[model samples]
Target chain A: DQQVKQNSPSLSVQEGRISILNCDYTNSMFDYFLWYKKYPAEGPTFLISISSIKDKNEDGRFTVFLNKSAKHLSLHIVPSQPGDSAVYFCAALVTDSWGKFQFGAGTQVVVTP
Target chain B: NAGVTQTPKFRILKIGQSMTLQCAQDMNHNYMYWYRQDPGMGLKLIYYSVGAGITDKGEVPNGYNVSRSTTEDFPLRLELAAPSQTSVYFCASSSSEAGNTEAFFGQGTRLTVV
Candidate 1:
């Protein structure tokens, strides 16, 4: 079973616009979420994260919003830059499982100039 | 900074053969992990260690063994390789004190079994 899921396989946005990536989780035990950006031939790099206690968390141009009632979370990049293009993965914390992580299939975000 | 180094960047093994993948991190993070990723699927944890001499199984721990003798190194051993084990393996480390923080991943080691 896929506890964490990013239904969208890919997304494309024009530079200077906003890019939104969404994720959902089936396990209610997950109380924290994280976003990672990956490029070809390199390991994934952490972007932003949010906790169940907070509805939103922001870091520079990146922001993460969570809705417990909907079991969903999203990452938004305002005034997206072409350099932001990469595969974005959403992950959830499985605390009961020794802090093991459950990741979504990931969405390829394309920020076109 | 050589955050996480995984040796033998690429390897090929025959079915039933055995091998070991080495991973070392300089960050001195308390948490280390091993994960595998396949096409169309996200990352799956194989094993992890909270500190030296302590290890735990992850979501996909079958057919694999791990040893953590020191905080800087965590090696994964494949006793008997299988075709299903052919995939990219990654090693990561994190400092949980940083609010259940982010993990730094290795460049990844691609393994193929015939």
Candidate 2:
């Protein structure tokens, strides 16, 4: 079973606009959510993260919003730039699973100029 | 500082062949993990190690083996290669400070089993 899911495989947004990527999870035991950005031929880099206790967390242009009631989380990038185009993956930490992280299928975001 | 390093960036193996993929971390992390990513699929855990001499299987551990002899090294072995095993493998490490923490990943190894 897929504990974490990102239904949208791809997304497109114009530069200077906002880019929103959504993710959902079925396991309630997950208390921490993280987002990673991956570029071609390179490893994924951590972007932002949010704990279950917080509804939102912001860092510069990146923001993560978590909703326990909906079992969902989203990454928002305001004034998106063309360099922001890449594959975004959302992962959840299974609090009881020895630090094993469950990652979503990933969403390919395209920021056009 | 080369947080995480994986050797053999690309390899091609024939069916029934066996080979080992090397991974090492200079961060002295106690937790290390091996994951494989298939086309259009999310990363799937293959194996992991909490510390030296302690290893555990992950979601997809069949046909694969791993050893954690030292905190800095974790190697994955493929007993007998299969076409289904063709995928990109990634090695990651993280500190044991908390349950929820970011992991540092290597560039990745692309393996093709023909």
Which candidate leads in lDDT?
2
Which candidate's TM-score is highest? Answer: 2
Cα RMSD, model 2? 0.9
DockQ in order = 0.67, 0.72
lDDT of 2 by residue, A1-113 (tens): 99999999999999999999999999999999999999987878889999999999999999999999999999999989999999999999965567798999999999988
lDDT of each: 0.91, 0.93
Kindly report which residue pairs in candidate 1 clash with one another: none
Given candidate 1, what's the lDDT at residue B66? 98
Chain A TM-score for predicted structure 2: 0.98
TM-scores vs. true structure, each candidate: 0.94, 0.98
In order, the interface RMSDs are 1.4, 0.8
User: How well docked is model 1, in DockQ terms?
Assistant: 0.67
